[model samples]
Target chain A: MSDVRLSNGSPTLERTDPRLPEHPKPSACKSLFGPVDHEELKKDFNAHLRELEEAAAARWDFDFANDQPLANGRLQWELVEHSSVPDFYSRPPRENGVCSGNNNVDHNGNHHCDGMAQSEETSRADSQMECTEQSSGPRKRSACHDPSAQSKRSHTSPEEVSCPNLSHSAEHTPRKTRRLSALQCVQ
Target chain B: MEDQLLCCEVDSIRRAYQDVNLLNDRVLHTMLKAEENYLPSPNYFKCVQREIVPKMRKILATWMLEVCEEQKCEEEVFPLAMNYLDRFLSVEATRKTRLQLLGATCMFLASKMKETVPLTAEKLCIYTDNSVQPGELLQMELLVLNKLKWDLASVTPHDFIEHFLSKLKICPSTKQILRKHAQTFVALCATDVNFIASPPSMVAAGSVVAAVQGLYLKSQDVSLSSQNLTNFLSQVIRSDPDCLRSCQEQIESLLESSLRQAQQHGGPAESKRVDEEVDLSCTPTDVRDINI
Candidate 1:
């Protein structure tokens, strides 16, 4: 913005700095809504997310917050081998976490709140156990089970009917390749 | 020296060339079809919001515009962020206290959508003066993305500006200046609640017509006159010419009021602006002072 200020009457040569200052304009920096109640805001957010999750679970018959595949879901989820599908489905999240990286990256390599991730991590583990009991009589867990595979369900599913790419990318690669072939298991 | 040269080559402006392919009828038709899906409820202030009001929206929009201008974000970011804000508010009746956080989250998402080097969460938090944490912003971002159903590619008025300008027979430089003025009008409209839920194509047409009238470019082309341009663009967007005329008039009055406010606050310097804008038209090229 300073490069072409000819009307200002300054004749000094300008530096070619392309970047803006690290800090934003001070005029717009002050908070507009006064102090935020972090505790209260957190509560509201959790409740909203829970509602979204429950609606999604009912509509799609899958519990995304818990990563459990519902039996009555219209389209069943069967664990597939990592090599069977694209590497993007099973790839570990980048070290920076997500593509641009903030703190939104979760176990499934998608952006979610820390609270959601915490609850999702615990519940998903429990759901995996529940699925284990149902899918395979008593199969032992394997090392290759890729965990970056949790996808959103229907209704309130973060996955939209309009966006097939997102849902496609949500398919997790099965770690127990030996058992996946024997049984169309839910991971 | 060769290695340094290679590094410098990569550091140039990180935007892609304007895709001429995007300025075609097919794309314009697609945008016309797609734009309605992204509009906020026109009466969201009455139905959806209890704590937030129109006046508060204006304040937040002004601040967001300031930040975008200072940070040199792309023209689309501010309006896109505003779209996100309105969409979220349309669905969720939020408290007045969390409005800034919502505004910041919208900006974060919009910047990521449009900018090559998106605004960082840390810097955005700093702009909030620590009222909201980076983590909170990140969380809010998730909520917003989910609320929006990750439909971030909302057709903005800027999207229609190119197509409208393409159909115009003006010279390239003339089109460029007219585009700037129209974009400023679109940004101004984004701040005002009246233009909400109006089709982006209509807003773009209105802005183009209003800008052409402001620039006094009717002498260059018959199509540039207020009536002819309104008819032409209204047809292009397939709306009633009268509706387009009304939208243009609303924009003109908005510009006039904004200039009047500037004059009241700007003292001697603004008096000069008033003199230039004597016939109720805002300055065409000066974008910095056109705060709404």
Candidate 2:
């Protein structure tokens, strides 16, 4: 009773044996199918990663819609009747709005929605690639560089297209990232 | 010897299964950790939820699409704003402060986190119309973060809406509406801030389904074969029909305003202008759809 100690220099309740209670350890690599072929899945996973990267780079941003900062917390009817509803965003731009002539906001001090800053473009590209790779059909094609498909896809999904952990192996994304996905895209 | 004994006591306190704050209290701290299953103190919740809904409605109403139509704030910034608000109010600070200042601090913290090129203190002052001070906002941000243990990770209604949409094998058009509904619904939840304790995804799914139901789109019936999908969606929308109706009223008003603004600013000639823009980029296959 006088000589009990825990790890980290913390004291432990005195017992006959001070050694840490032993328990069965978990398997180092648990797979859906016992003893999974890591080599096969690894290659497949890598291909998916590359496809996502390429798709992201090729994605575009063409939304010309301008939404004012929400007054209070909701939209006002008066402003809605007077202002044009913004078109949704498209893909990453070749240039930022500051560099593009579209940077000129309306007389009403509206911020430019067409031109995404570089960092946003980068994140969008990353999200785009990830989104395309996650999908299985025609939408999966990287249409960012293909201006023809860009417009068609614009009516599809906006930034919500690039959700984290959307793939079969989505579970592999870090827990931290998955948790952040909870916030979605408010900020 | 005294230092060693003190260290042991501190270690024991840290190792205690129950919270240390539970000792000697009329109200238990355990109750503090209790699920905010109910709304916050009705007074504060009502203040933001009731006032902000109409205000957001006004903003949504007047927005438009244009060649040079400026982007409002980035979508990325919105979550941060919501997070700032949520984290700020999660504490017991409401006992000490008022709602207006709390709401202002949330905006300040969120603007800094979300905006790529954030607004300045002066701009924020103008934005909130001098409701709060930059110094106070900054101080509040730090205080809120500390209260939240700097755990900034948040799940928004948008994220849940996205996941819920993906669960269905729906068309892209439907998906788009779902996306809109999700955003709108999340914004709607802000009006009923008592639901803040619920995950954003759950709130988004719940609100979207409710919005869909209100719009006469029986999303639950969309997947009739999948009872799981139907039941899951049904539960979410069923909780508060009245809140859903109120949200729908807000959205309809906003949409009307947005369309009106588009018409006034966009003009009759705008249709042709957008058509030409669309024609310039639309592919050969899409040509038929464009005409139709």
Candidate 3:
């Protein structure tokens, strides 16, 4: 086992096998890249070698299992934790008026608040129409056409914008026949 | 004293072999995801309308190989550097003038990852004949790190060599020879772009099969026939035999062509002249335009 030699004679591996071949002198192939100042390269290489030695020595004292710096004051390992969502998602929503209540954020921070608000408004209209049948549909239809409806639409636009059938029910039902006709129309 | 040292070495090797399962799990988890993270687009250089053709890449790889050989870098460094180069090229439309600088920077980064003693920025800059500054190399290093998403733990064919080799029932001497040949084959694969599509494990298995077959051919040994070696490698690497066979064939063809080219070049001196001529022809005009 001791007599075995690797062809290139890697230093670290050679340390384990004393019988490995002697390190070849730096060869002329070094010139292949270009005219390198050998003295400067040797200096740089030696500095790098010392740094590696220090790092290796530090590694021996470092505690990998606990991932903590040991008494030697060396970093054992660096752990990088990646977030599934982008940075913006992890941040608190902006306090601006445009996206005030829209907290349902996708990974990219696109708000789902508009959809939520629409659904809530539609349910509100449904209950309102159930309470006062005759006046609600006509008022809602008028609201859809009214310029002021834009502001009110945030709260009531589901009936005005989405449910056009409510308008038809209001026109068809007589005041006395409102409840029965409304139910029939809904069915 | 020698016997005692040998005993300790054997014990360490045994312990390492015992921990292979843990090592494999960690390597698979990190490397597979890292592979997914930074794949080079197949035709990005062309899509970007860049002047970097396959011929230029081949020349660059050859130069990188020379640097690694001269420096006596680990087997993993050159391939890993090439991975960085390809991934960076896929994402960034690099100027032709900066290609060698990019190569040097990739080598620097890969050495940091794989070698005990990494090549310093100063040395790398010197390798470029001061055409690139150390500051510039450091900047490019950061750019590469960002583009790779800071995931440097790549799984090259070298990673799978030991696992594949351990499964073979050959004698110790034959195993060592096979490992050397397999290493050479892996380095050869890194120099060509065609092998880029193959997964690292497939490349490893293929190279081992090719190495064994190569050795067997030289010796005219019936035991090293393609069929037996293919079955053995596929079983060891836990890949489909068909895929492994195809990859092995590709490697064999690569080896043949490279050998033919080496012969055609006549010798190293002539080939060096050809490389220098290519470098001189490409750099001056490109560098001037980039500067302006």
Candidate 4:
């Protein structure tokens, strides 16, 4: 029976709108409060993202910013075949380019761009815009940007980690990022 | 291989058909247990937020609901977004000016979690009159994800409504109409601040009972009577009968007050249209009154 469609249509939402179903759909386009100060918002968001990355780094003991496993991290990073884990953890990036940059995180920590990385690069432009605009204080590049680690850490770029997607590696991000977290502490 | 794509259904928005496999007691019990983990702290304004007050939340919620309706978003997106908003506010002390930004970001995240074709950041910015930029929304979306620990699969009142309806013996048409009414009540509950921290299953039960009362549907079974159904649903959600009844009363009062308020602010024809929509009751005065 059609009963199984259960809350599938727009009828009920229309009923509950408190607007009379007509009258030009209420042009609720005006700002609810006032304009947000982009400067303060940018600063505050940068701090929050940095704090989250640090907290995750401490919790997991992996240098998420450098894409390198800490010597003392509680869990080991290993590389498993893509077929080993559920596809939920290894599916290719979706159209949104959410975790597209993390495809740089491969088995050998190599800096080379495979076909998948180039294809997914389209979505990372959103992240790039986010990075350049929000970094109020100079960007945090303690190890990744240090020229000393440049050759060895060529696998991860400062821009990729700064793109607000770093938190993806720490927790519930696109599954392909599981590669970055993949227990490959093969260093 | 390419022709197989043509054989599949394509639509602007995608939705999975309801799996009857999940409509069993096992799933219902699991949902009841999971709802508690996702509830917001009831007194976050007093204990956590220095600038945000409950009244402001009501305004934000009203705006979010309107946007969802305008976009024809899935029924679950608005409430799920509100859940994210409340959970974030519960732990963080946000400035009053940024509240709408937070609200918009919550919608952005929730729409992605629930919709096949989610709302765009640019459209959401336009909805806000461009007060908050898309970049800000994206940054806030990430902060919200971190604060909420990436748990977007929240159990909403919509989830519980399906399981409740499944146990009823009514025909598909009656079930369909009643589901619509219950869903309206659930959305109404989401907009009001009082229902904060109410377990989703209880809210769903109260809403189902209230819908049963408003429609005054008839069935041969003894349990469909308003009081019996309330008791039955309360048991199903594992709550006290008195608590469920009181919740039902709260929902009724909320509806009455919102309708009166809508009439005050809305046009004269507005109330009339609302009356025409609730057409199932036997008597206009009896059902339209909104009080038993």
Candidate 5:
């Protein structure tokens, strides 16, 4: 109901704040993650990464084991990188910004068409560069900021977003039935 | 623990059992044939729901116990009917013989796939007051499946409602209240066939609005504008005042009926359970069998 505006000034509200979740980098573990030793955190993270790699190799084996404590290691990292981890991880930053009185913007902002466009462009560029970035495996293709790269299609026109400056070119049009598989996350 | 693993395996096993495509195609063909044999009703397939089957129990007997039987069941049946209608219209010409029968058969097939224990054709016929013959039901079922060309991996509002409700950390009472509203939405769906084509998300939002409307109707203070419905659909489907009003009436009547039945059959303890309090913690927890 609140008529807050997106940074792009479009009239649709964003689902969540785009800022990434604060998963403390291993080296910076103590302050944000709370009292965790740096060495221990690094060791745990390395172990987690190893498990993820093992799981990746055995992806066929890990069906939805609803009752069991399945690692969800990939989903965990995907969520973290996507900033979809619970609010606890990101609540502090919002608290710090609460004094600005702009926090009310969270519930009621127009959709971010420009940011979506920018993010899409960045992701498409990343997709193009992905072949060369194979050495980094999964880490280098940071999806922390733009979750929609996989399916945030350019179905709408620039005119729809009121992007008058850009030319409406055929090449930029998103393919109608672009196949999106989970494995595309590697890109 | 083994049960959980079995449930996981059940998803894949259940996938194969889901022969809705075949079922839908067969049902549609039967419907077309039926229409060819009779005069078409103004309400199209919905006449099956309203006239052919006077009561919800007739269409869905014991299966109504679980969920999405009548109120939740209406929208479910509509889209299914639409899918059949769409396929039939695209391929074959329209007729008036047994269109309502066609719609009912699709609902019967869909209800079986949607619910675990589907009522038998005999039971369904018994419920419909012996108006439809067993052979006719079977014939329609096969025809609907054929018309659909066996492609029936359609979504339902129940699926979307489950997803959205899980995300919300509202109280159990609120959840029940929300579900009641959703029932209204399903009923409203009966008034119009177009809503059957809507995606699951739109249905969820519509159901939420319907629930809000139900609350408003009860409390007499809260009011919602047509703009809310417009915002929900993003102006996709214009709200039909008559249809919305009719759907609301059906939902209220259905709920009242359920309450009456529960009171008569569900002993004091069962009734108390209906009134029991559940926690409203906002934490995400797994709910079983979300698909409908």
Candidate 6:
């Protein structure tokens, strides 16, 4: 596990890093409600929602504040973004990074950064604006100097890398259509 | 004109099915592997060593299910919520009193992830009879998210159902029925802690197989041979035959006992009695002791 921390510490983790599979997007597909009478259901659902909203509003009047301290000492509502944390839990050493290193050696020889380069190209195309800034000058020189460091840089930019795979799969019409059919069948 | 449109729709569905078949295998594999880290320790409730028990979890899961059903929330919401609850209990030594609060908070988080219109924090508090405040639920939500390292996309058995069903060569009519029954089995699996031992894909395959068998037993023309089912499931899930069979057996046994219980005590009324019986002995405690 400590080894995972060391490996993920590298700056080059790309979208295609097999270790870090993209977050499973919440499936948009709806459940099969069976032979539900829509008119009856809509009426019931509306009444239920209205009742719930009323009850909730009543609770909100007196119980608005959480007992837990929000942000140090002050009581303020806040949204914390967790995108900065590279997903370290999922990356077992055998599946990605170090293992890919051996594959790099076996497939592309000493230019081990070849696999990283391919993924980086995809990432570059995927996030052109971000890649343009990061892929130029010092970073590229440093990447050339050390293959391991290059892998690190590629692995670290998960947002740039992971987003494309999700969008790519969704944009791919066949998968999208099948998801639609599956959703329809469920209904 | 109708026939041409039908043919085009079938062609599109078939093409999409093929694409998903390829993608589902890779995705399921990655998810199963990643889930190992997120699973709460099996003895998490035991380790907490208070009023918490395995039965309490069952009761809480039932309540969570009812809440989801009442809201018409997505099928994934309840199971995903259970995952959060178990993961939280594993790490935190929670008081028995806060179990429902934990369950509600988990549901709140999961509905946000899986539903089009999530259950509001205020609404979840109302479900708890106003014992908990919205702010507290929100606080617990953040605590759980942080504890889980913001990995809310943990795979549930539902993710694998469509993939497995597509692999089977069944008639279109029965496919809908089979999918529905399979979903019920998945929900059943979520209520029991034992199912956690099996990977989500295996549970899904098992549920589909069991649903087919259950449906077939009622009438005989389904054409679903065990050998064919086993071969297809093994290939698609990339699992050993023995593991799949064991999981199938577990699900079958769970179904049998549940069926027997329902028959003996007349269903929902009895389950409600059991829940009331369990709740009778509880003493309320401050939420601070929840130890998130």
B163-186, model 2: which lDDT tens digit per residue? 455556666665555455445445
- Order by lDDT, highest first: 1, 4, 3, 6, 2, 5
Please report, in order, the local distance difference test score of every candidate based on alpha carbons: 0.68, 0.36, 0.54, 0.65, 0.35, 0.51
- When 1 and 5 are scored with lDDT, the better candidate is 1
Residue A98 displacement in candidate 5 (angstroms) = 61
- The alpha-carbon lDDT assigned to residue B191 of candidate 1 equals 84
Off by over 4 Å in 1: A1-21, A59-85, A97-163, A166-187, B1-10, B267-292
Candidate 3 reaches a DockQ of: 0.02
Per-residue lDDT tens digits for candidate 4, residues B95-141, read 98899989998988887776545676767777788888876777777
Q: TM-score of chain A, model 3?
A: 0.18
Choose the strongest candidate by lDDT.
1
The candidate with the higher DockQ, 4 or 6, is: 4
Using lDDT as the measure, name the better of candidate 1 and candidate 6. Answer: 1
lDDT of 2 by residue, A1-187 (tens): 2123211111111111211222211211111112323355335434533443344223333211211112242111111110121111222233432112333221111223443443354344445434322222222211122122213333244333332223322222222122122112211
DockQ of each: 0.21, 0.01, 0.02, 0.18, 0.01, 0.02
In the predicted model 3, the residue pairs found to clash are none
Task: Report the TM-score of candidate 6, chain A only.
Answer: 0.18
Candidate 3 accuracy as lDDT: 0.54
Tens-digit lDDT string for candidate 6 (B108-186): 8787775434577656666666656554555455456545755677777776776676666666666766776677778
Model 4 segments beyond 4 Å from truth?
A: A1-26, A68-172, A175-183, B1-14, B218-222, B267-292
In order of appearance, the predictions have TM-scores of 0.76, 0.35, 0.53, 0.71, 0.33, 0.53
| DockQ head-to-head 5 vs 6, winner | 6
lDDT-better candidate, 2 vs 4: 4
Off by over 4 Å in 5: A1-187, B1-90, B127-131, B167-169, B194-200, B217-292
lDDT per residue for candidate 5 within A69-151, as digits (tens), equals 12432321111122432222222222222112221111111112233443454345435433322222242212111111222
Say which prediction, candidate 1 or candidate 2, comes out ahead on DockQ. 1
